[model samples]
Target: MNKSSLKVVAIGGGTGLSTMLRGIKKYTSDITAIVTVSDNGGGSGILREEMNMVPPGDIRNCLVALANTEPIMKQLLQYRFKEGTLKGQNFGNLFLAALADLSGNFEKAVQVTSNVLAITGKVLPVTLENVQLYATFEDDTCVEGETQIVDYSKAHHKMITNIRLEPRNPKPAEAVIEAIEEAEMILLGPGSLYTSIVPNLLIDEVAQAIRTSRAQKIYIANMMSQPGETTGFTVENHIEELEKYIGVGTIDTVIVNNENIPEEYLKKYMEDGAHMLSFDAQHPIWKLIKRIEAPLVRINHEKEYIRHNQEKLAEYIFDDF
Candidate 1:
């Protein structure tokens, strides 16, 4: 098989998907990012609440990641407005919002924007509907909205039973389904387990399509658990929950961090109530899966530790696929 002809579909939201997309673009131009749209926080939340539109932050990030424009254009799009009423504003978000208004469809807006920017690969939303994410804790308590669920679950220290999308039975975008069918490999997350990966799975058709697809499915585990959402989560626990929600044996491989954390950074993370995820090699769950070590994990200038080197990580995934 010609490696360059490989078709890949990456699913998730936030910086994780963007980072993965950046790396994957190096190997194949035939890539599609099926992003989550359930975000209800920060700039995205404000826009979704006010305009009754799907959150644009994740979409914006994916766009910038896959953009094939000059370096200056990439930098410009990522620039945030830091003054006046626009403080903390993302320029790309505003551009996407305008495109949505002009095209009369969010998906179309993304396509037009990508065409204009000459993005490297396609970026798609799992669903175009304005959907909210809700969580039901193991204690039988329910919290609505992604941001609220994050806050309330943390404050109360509860186990999340499951997460669901609002508006009930949303139809996954046709483009997303098509992408799944065409993909040579499908990747699920290095993002928020609940808010990102699960939101995409909550859409029944999307989940079913993923379960049935012929593509090699890989789960890239998050390096660290999110505070309220996945606290104390082990690598096995993450995969187990995903299997429970989607389907058993849906994932063919698991990529995990093998790099050790520095004591200084580990101490700071401990202070912040977070810790690096552990991969116990002898664990029963580990026995049943294919594990790959990602050894270049480090803190970037952003002050947060990311999974590993992007291009090198992509090389690992590509080799497996």
Candidate 2:
């Protein structure tokens, strides 16, 4: 299919989803990102508590990613205040918050922001209901908030056993379901396994839509294991954990990074309690899904961080899948 005709739906939140969108938008304008709204941390959590609205942080990131506006406009939205009452708050979050108030709905605010940004594609919240993420540790202790879940896991060294939305079964957004139905390709992850990716699956109809969609379902595996979440998780481990919620065989393809990082950078990540995801040839998940392994990694010299090369990632998806 041609780029303009391909309807692609990407699911997940945070930098990973936005990062992927930057590349995907280069190939197709018919993109829809279904972002998780379960965040309860930082400026987002504060805004949610005070404004009684869904967190806008992730939505803001997605907006900037697909934006075709000037660099100044992008910088303006992303600029965070250094001091004052707005300290630690991002301009984009405030912009979204203001729009939510003016529009009388958070989702509408998102739509308005999308128009203002001149983004290439649409961004849809997974659910409209105000929901929080919760998790139960392997030891059976429960954590109430997304930020707390990460902190507790890291501090206690307990792996998460179960995760779910607080409101249980929030009605999935109509736009989200419709987007999935019309999509030619559906992508998941390259984000936090618990906080970013799985939370979307926890939504009843969202997961159901994915399962029933005729689109080719692809999952971009994280390059590095998250310290507090997937400490020692491998590519297969990530898929297996996801399958627990979405069911086996729902995902048709797995794209993983087989590139090696320099020892210096690897040491830095290891010292921070993270590691490269191991690629196992005999993983049981292989029976259920196709694996596409490649040297998809790109290290940022300035920040000393590693992420999937956006152009390469987009090209691979367009050419191979």
Candidate 3:
């Protein structure tokens, strides 16, 4: 089959999902983003609280990433309001909220929004129902919600024991299942390990589908450890944690950053309890690692902090896949 005919299903949320989608969409039109819906912060949080809807921030990010619009249009979609009363409101998030309201269905809202924006590929919520994430620490302490779990982990400096979706069971969207079954490749994160990647696995059907599918599964590890969530974690620990949630030998390959980060930034991250993801040649999983000397080590636009360079990232993801 030709490259464009290769279907792909990417799972995760936050900037990682968007970053991978921006890259993969360039290779194939058959892209489906199965995003996490556990966010309870920012504009998506406000809308979720008021309307009792699934958090829209992650979904909004995926929409913009897959959008086929010009650079200016992408900028506009990502533009945030910085004024009294409506400060830090993202245009794309609000637009998605409004569409959800109008359609009276979150899934339909995503479909309508993607079509209206002329996005290059399909974007989907990992689950359609309003759901919350809960985590149990290695100490057996329990925490509810993604935000709370991070706060608990930060204060305790413990690894997460397990995570599950509230309500325990949810019907996976038929489209999501179809995409997974039909995909030639499935990409997991470079996102928050506990908050983004693990939550997707918490769903029984989603996990089962992934296990049964024949797609080549690749995990793109994050360059920097997240504070509280993955403090002092190595590239091996990242893979180990993924296995804890998704089962062993689930990842066929891993892509890690090989570039060196500056000491100044490293100090700042360390203060936040973050660590650089170390790739050790002696490690058992080292043979599966594909190191990309990515300049993802630097800041972007002074405000966005760090981001993967789109053009270079796109080329590499396809090259490896």
Q: Whole-model Cα lDDT per candidate?
A: 0.84, 0.89, 0.80
**Model 2 alpha-carbon drift over 4 Å, by segment:** none
Ranking by lDDT: 2, 1, 3
How close to the true structure is residue 67 of candidate 2, measured as C-alpha lDDT? 97
Q: What lDDT does model 2 reach?
A: 0.89
| Per-residue accuracy of model 2 over 1-321 as CA lDDT, tens digit each | 477769999999988999999999988899999999988999999999999998989989999999998999999999999999989999999999999999898888988888888999899989888998889988999999888988887787778888989789899976889999899899998899999999999988888889989999999999998886788788888988888777788899988888899998999998878889997888776877888888888888899998889888888777766
**lDDT per residue as tens, model 3, 271-310:** 7777888877687776665445455554664563565555
Q: List the residue pairs that clash in candidate 3.
A: none
Model 3 — which ten-residue stretch has the worst lDDT?
289-298
Model 3 ranges off by over 4 Å: 70-72, 286-298
Off by over 4 Å in 1: 301-304
Q: In model 2, what are the clashing residue pairs, if there are any?
A: none
**Which predicted model would earn the best lDDT?**
2
